[model samples]
Target: MRADPTRASSADASETDPSGDDRAHDAAVPIARSLEAILMVADEPQSLVSLATAVGAPTAAVRQAIESLVADFDGADGGTRRGFELREVGGGWRFYVREEFDPVVRDFVLTQNPTKLSQAALETLAVIAYKQPITRSSIAQIRAVNVDSVVRTLLGRGLVTESSTDSETGAITYETTELLLTHLGINSLDELPLISPLLSDGRGGFDDVA
Candidate 1:
């Protein structure tokens, strides 16, 4: 009997291989494109499992494609200025603005608020923004003043939040809120306006003048 090539091919195609190499390849095409779409549409970083399920591909394969896409972006020249980067934050993967180009990027996107922050409010906010999830006592110690009023003002302005309470000490830990990022016109706290002098100010006394 002569061997039938077409029948063999059909049989091979129909067979369910435990190994998903072939499926991974076929899935990768749409998956790769879908990953881009998801990242573009997402408000924040998404997880590997989320991307895989969203693109209907295996998590491993989607991760591989994501790495490839990131490599391609890094290799491209315009990409650096565009300031697009892929990063993992809060235990999930997401797209982020590259740190090197934030100034120019913010100029185009963020509008300045005419409202000015008082020295005390600015001081408290700075502490919360930098050493976030920090206790009120810690902030008070740094500011060298009672921060109850400052904390209340920040909370009222929607820029900071009492993130947690210490189980043992019962102290309230404050941190910058999502509203803070939005108000600052940035995507994350990591992109907060960098004041080199403020960062270097060991005494924690710095001006927030525009």
Candidate 2:
């Protein structure tokens, strides 16, 4: 027997794949599609490392997938440009509504949602009112609850507005809008009543509204 083919083939296969990483990568969902699914529901911009780990792909592959998504959303590959785009801001990727659609979206939200805010919304709003330029994460930490939907409700009602996303972290800060002042019939935030007296522990961290 001249050098058994079975042993030779086994040796070659072992040499080619010393680790099972390739199989795992191949088994994962397509990188681009998986990334899209995650970014769609992501509240904050996702960094390359985080996204790569999340999708079980190599960083190089994830970067390539991100580029492909950016082009696809921008219609650079001969398709209609989407109403939203994948943007890299604060050193991470996130989706943003096209600026031109703002007015239409705003009008629709205002008209469609007329019922008064639920108690949760009111509490969330109070936190933002006093902690101007606060991030959603901070709000949730303070209230000890998730406030994602409540923040969206405030944004839709035009009672809360966002500041520029943090340049390094991609964190979006929120503050009460003029509409909030109008709703309260207050000329300025300073005019709001002090809530320190109402605190059980008499904490000073709370401002005139929080």
Q: For this target, which candidate reaches the highest TM-score against the unseen true structure?
A: 2
Q: Indicate the worst ten consecutive residues by lDDT in candidate 1.
A: 201-210
Model 2 poorest 10 in a row by lDDT: 20-29
For each of the candidates, the C-alpha root-mean-square deviation to the true structure, in angstroms, is: 12.8, 5.8
| lDDT (0 to 1) per candidate | 0.71, 0.85
The best candidate by lDDT is 2
lDDT (Cα) of model 1: 0.71
Off by over 4 Å in 1: 1-26, 76-82, 111-210
Model 1 error, position 113 (Å): 7.8
Candidate 1 lands at a TM-score of: 0.44
Model 2 spans with C-alpha error above 4 angstroms: 1-29, 166-170, 204-210
lDDT of 1 by residue, 37-110 (tens): 88876643577887888888787888888876777667664554345877765445667668786566545433
Clash tally, candidates in order: 0, 0
Query: What lDDT tens digits, residue by residue, belong to model 2 across residues 1-210?
Result: 599999999999999874676664454438889999999999877999999999888898898788878888899958889999999867789998888988888899989998999999998998888887888888898888999999989998889987767654678889999999999999999998776777786564564454
